[model samples]
Target: MTSAAAVPTSLLRPAVNTAHAARVSVLAPTNKAHLGNLEHLFRNRGAVESTATAAAAPVQPVRRRRQAPLLRLPSFLKRARGDVAAIATQEEQVYLSPRLFQPVPPDGPSPRGDIAAAWQRLHGADGWRGLLDPLHPDLRREIVRYGEFVDAAYGAFLARPDAAPGDADAVRVPLHDPAYRVTAPLFATSSVGLPSLLALAAPCAAQRTSLVGYVAVCENQDEVRRMGRRDIVIALRGTCTVLEWAENVRAGLVPATEAADAAPSTGDASAPKVECGFWNLYKTAGDGSPSLSEMVVSEVRMLLKKYEGEEVSITVTGHSLGAALAVLIADELAGDGGAPTPVAVFSFGGPRVGNRAFAERVEARGARVLRVVNAHDVVPHLPPRPGGRWYADVGRELRLDSRASPYLRPDADAGCCHDLEAYIHLVDGFLSSHCPFRANAKRSILRLLKNQGANVKQLYISKAVDMRVRLDAVDMPGSPLGRLGTPPSTVLECVH
Candidate 1:
């Protein structure tokens, strides 16, 4: 009997195309009688049989080059079942670092309801002293939730520039992204409070209408409401336009105010010649002129006058551009001595809004400030915080480590890290272990991950490309592989 190894080398290793190899059907022993027919067909069709089947051929594992593990693989695939020896490898594979921020101790008690309720509970009679208490898990979670609302506020306000303060449903035309389906309103005006103040950018011919910021009036419950006490939350939307970027680039340092009696300058001229973007934003109106701060001051005065002789607590909250506005609004409201006293500001991803003198004025107002910063967010590092007091951040800071966030990776594009949704997602993860909502929260997060992936796959790239097509799709400069800043519809994707 001739050995199988004695077959001709050409016949043994047929010239089969790799593309067609996986598609070839297996032949059964019963079909051996038709070998002659099969050979005749192969000859006629210009096809070659691959004796070295893909399954039969030994595939040598490609050596993993010594480099940082770039992609975060699924947890299940990282380790072997019951294999203690793989622990070290698995540990090295994890993309997350230890928690960067510690849990703030609880205050006197946890607040209830939505962001409005939490605001009312935190900022009571004396001042923001209650709010400045190391954030209770309850307050933190609520603030994080409100962060999403603040994000939604931009879309909502932009959708209905003409929306009346009483028209809650009209204001919330309901965009699908970020997905805050807030139905019930604390009052018809403000969703979950008294009324809302929507501030549109100064009219620009380039853009028809733009919403720069808004104030949500969260009243303390009926007991406090009857007493006419209300907590004001001012949320500013971040830059969504090239026009806004132009404002950011106009970084010449200026006095916080035009008044000669303005707050004393910090007197540190050695610092960079950059001014706070927030001050320019505050001074400038939407029409590419100056008036936004004046509008905010007017609205605040109206609210204060409406609730005269009653205790009022105002807390300014915003992300990115809105965050800078939040701090400035707090300073404005507290400075007038007519709006309210002891204001508090919670700023997320806020750029350095003003010079040292500006920050001092905000601080002097007795406003309690908490600047919530996420690790890797490029916004906070802006207006550039170098040695001297050129542009400076004002307030206490709550730093969060987003390295383990599901929406991010160790090497995620830094711009995606600047997203407000990403910040909320990180905050939710921080509260998951300690809060009652953990069980439901985990399910929701998993669903979000799955849905987010599905949504991204529906995009043009995934629909058009096959496995054979390399995913070297262009990544814009200063952007991540999948997340592009332009064309707002782009999805976050990372292809290896």
Candidate 2:
């Protein structure tokens, strides 16, 4: 836990509501279409036209006043309006035309041709120079897969909120790609002083410690051969409790070395600094348990030792708050010279974690970070740099626009914009910034939206489209589970 002496009272106080302001900006239109429409509607509100007299008096020639020069819309607004119109037209067609029920593509492993050869580039070694613009198909698949791992963490926590960490059956959902096996569950305790709503909601919240994520390993030899390395994954879910949300609001910067288990510092002003709240959450421990940092470092070290003398890579993934933690974990893991491996982070809708120097420190350790952001999501722009506190984004960014997807409403709320499921959905259908959402995106839109508690009544999903393809448990070459004949049926409603 952070020492009281280290954090000043001013830093602990809640800052201005910049997050809300950013959210309002995100929801506001970037074009003048709404204003123009209103103007046109009320142009002659109080004036009554005499149609009969005007028709009768048409014989006389009338002098016309020169019209004022029309105001031109900005180029970006023109593009925004064009995209909105295109999406509207597409949705209209889907609603008016006969529904086409096509067989959904099987959810098998997407053919990532020689991922082993280009894994470094995919992992942002060269800052993903050419891979992000067109969005390399392999990278897209990997992003979605890691995103699913994060989703699985959410499912686990929701299913058994009080379940002890490291429970073998903690994760209830089977990943689309059954290449990885859960090794251990990860947990974190809040060090914030604020009163928590979680204490009233669940018994586990009283402890200030809850399961956050899990560590998995690619144990399948086929997957290892295909990837050319044994991959270790650390997947974390976003904030779900009141205490976690409270911790997120503490944006004060503290030296990175303030962490209990952090390395000795050189005692200079140039040392890296991180968000005070995040550091406290990462370093704090429940009653008798180890801090999140200690648990993760210990688990990773053991895994590295077990996979010694083999090509190995570490991928840390999370959504929202989890994304921030993922960056922290990657930095810590990379700083430990004893375990030498390429460390990469795929963060979805994550906020800024630290200052510019902290980012430099992470890069100096050779850790690569790729932040996946929804252009409309406000969370990524959070913990505002008040008085120029030096908060900075730390990696290559892949920005996706929610407007590209025809299935979503144009007026999506802040929650919908920041939802992890929506982020994954956008990633699945994303082709490029210049391209529309892919027509053949195989993920069930209805399923994704429903999981996020979105209104799916307006969403049109054909009966066949609702079904997801799953590899039979026995069909998986090295799956530990016995044969599970068929996947469960998904009943979907098609409301016209």
Candidate 3:
């Protein structure tokens, strides 16, 4: 029942545990019952001999309980039961034997044939039509990839010792995919007088602005060809400072056209209106710096011109408050009539950003938005739409349930539910709404474990410890223990 605000800031950021690497390196076994013992083995290395001896001494037998007699059902009743039993069996297997402890293969799920040929569908050209139901493999990979970009943005922001805006290289975040190079770092300033946790030690002037994110462009020709187009990515991080969190709750709607560069309003009650806080964050500027909108628009225009005559696409991605800014950025780029390529936004756990008119404007601008929402997450339903003030979500939604993944606790806190890592984990394991978490999901569970902290059980760590012990015993040339390869899938089970 603990609120998100009560959660420490360390939980929000990624934790670096030196032992995690050693723990995860040996997590390849398939048995779940030995998990607890494995955890003990790792934590107490001296107990290994005692543990092995204890395992050798186990020889207990249990009495079986009497079973109830089967009911005699009619032929019609048998036919009506058709696949129900089969589905129940499958669900049991999936839930009981999750892939939390399995090692991620060197190469993940096979590439979706040729990504170039299906890039449009993957980019939400047709409103994602059939890609979301079963969750296409290519789209899943792309979602995780973009989610990492947002994580990188967060890393860059937190790495800064001071809040002052720095050079492009200072704020540039290293990405997993080296195909894309960060072109420029983006900074945003707020005119609103709000306190910030980040700049409490610095001057008030330095606290007004900080590095928010960056713009990256695909420079590797091979990657460009594989993707079917040159991709320009604008990845933004969510609210971290106290000032931004305060802005998040300012749900009052204001005219989007109040800014000089904004699209002209029709001067009517139906005019497009955006959240006042989001607008101020986007349009506000420091003493001499350009606003977030200016920096993004200028950088995007430069990239579009630089990559002219080539097949190109603009992808904007973010989480939470960043997601709201992403929607606004997409609206601006698509409506400006300056860029000729398709613009799309991939939003994770984003709250409502505008009213009905603002949504229509975004659609009219031809910007495609796909909102990935965790059903149990409270952020997506935030900035609530009360009776008088209107606030409408503006995107096609792909909903996920946190309860689907056995790796996650059923009673996870709001922070755990809203964590970007959790969103990526859910997307990676997603199959269909009717289906359980995919057993062969390729995303590593280590990240989830690190983020969920006390929320997740020790099953993941225990499995790894068990696998290491088994491998060392068998793989060694002259070991006393005989070879015991991975256990059968039938014995694969999860402990809570």
Candidate 4:
């Protein structure tokens, strides 16, 4: 039997050569870093037109439990049966514009009234707090303490009991390729609250220079558990306590430079981490304002203690909704420290976030939030808005999906995708595009340009390319600051 791993990234392309890979120019690659970088700006701007409803702090009745995370393969495959069957029946994949910043219609015919009701059923998002809200006050407090614990333990771990591999500031980059020098940043993945995602990154966190993160697309705990197991079945081994989205895969090593001994500087903690796995339940566009606001605030607090004086490898990645969340989160982290650090945010179908205001925020933060979309999944395009018609000034939607050919035969693909890993990818690739991580890319790019020069204008990258600022637009000496920034889209401003 042909394993899915046999398929290379290029195999997913179609005969039309319209895949996102083709449109995304290397030099013109849309930067997905700044979307949430300006989250700090938003965080500070409590005065920015607060809505009257702001005072009505809505609450939910559902109970909040400590969500643990993963997926066991046999069961994982069995569970995603319905979704898999759905994908298999489709004949082909579909592609949409990659300009992710465009505004979604606040009021439009929803794909399903039930989904809208789902939003309202949970007290219009209040109920979700019990189900998936990682920002629970207790959780936030735990996260803060956890960050502190991680910081202290990590420092001691690097200090070592008897001997260490290298300097405390410098460590080996774990890699399959011996040729590679620095240790690769590991990814922890879980569909829901699988503990493996937490486990892999958790152990890595023991290293002061390591970065640990997770990606949650499946809002259900069962799904997360299943995903945790399947991930273990894929790359990692043994009994892991947590399953993170990027737990197994590691981005290229963070080159240990001569400044390994230098103390870390305090960048703005106001930037939030990528969106939490719990946000799959967040369906309303109106929630963006407050939800994102809270995320920024929580992340600032978490990071304040976690990264106060550390030289850890900053990694950014997530699946489905998480991937999108990572987009904005990466922006904030990158801007805090110097250098355009590479934090890979591999998203599966994410959704739109906000106007150019958010995109500029992403640009200021250094993030390359790479988004991946499966072609067969219709969820990516769901919560359908009017075609290029919206009430607010939104940015562009990035690529529809990099892998669209599979959607051409949705039935076949969806049928075989019964595993939690497969299901999470399907849900993310189809359903969630407003990944917090991806949402901020454009804003970060624009902010980078704007901060450098007021005359900064947004350069038009290809359609497949995200609408965020391209690195080529920056004025850095060694970098590709060749292109001049363009003003906001006057055309879109004139139109819907």
The prediction achieving the highest TM-score against the true structure is 3
Clashing pairs in 2: none
Give the CA lDDT, 0 to 100, for residue 410 in model 3. 85
| Model 1: per-residue Cα lDDT over 1-496, one tens digit each | 1222333333223223333233221211122222222222212221111123323222222223455332322322222223121112222112111111111111212223233223343332233232332234444554564575566566665566544334544554232211122322111111011112312333331342245656555443642443234545566667764455655665556565643123334466532222434455565443332356666666667777776776666667788877876776777777777434557776778878776666777777777777878768888888775685477778777666565443344565565567676666556544322121111121122122222232221222232222121222334332222342233333222110
- The residue ranges of model 4 lying beyond 4 angstroms of the native Cα positions read 1-313, 337-340, 382-409, 412-496
Per-model CA lDDT versus the true structure: 0.45, 0.65, 0.66, 0.26
| Model 3 lDDT tens row, 396-415 | 99999998776777887798
For candidate 4, which ten residues in a row score worst on lDDT? 230-239
Against the hidden true structure, what lDDT does model 4 obtain? 0.26
Give the better candidate number (1 or 3) by TM-score.
3
How displaced is residue 96 in candidate 2, in Å? 16
Top lDDT model = 3
Give the alpha carbon lDDT tens digit for every residue of 1-496 in model 4.
Answer: 1233333333223312324324332212122222222322222211111122424222211222334211111111111111111111111111111112221221222111121112121111122223111112221221122122222222232334222222323422222111112221222223223356654666543321112221111223332232221110001111122232332221111111222122222123232211222122121112112233233334444443543443223334343334444554555555556433233333444443322334446544534333333445443442233553211111222233323212112233332221123322222222123221122111112222322322222222221124222232234322233353333221110001
lDDT of 2 by residue, 1-496 (tens): 1122343333223322346335433443222322222221122111111123212211121122355212221121111111111112332232211111111122334344456656766677677766776677677878987888898788778776765544535445434446688888888888854445755666555657778888899998988887768999999889987678888887777788745434323244366888777787788887777888988999999999998989889999999999999999999999988756999999999999988899999998989999999999999998776666568889889999887766566776687789887898888777676555554354544344344333222332222123222212223222212232234332221110
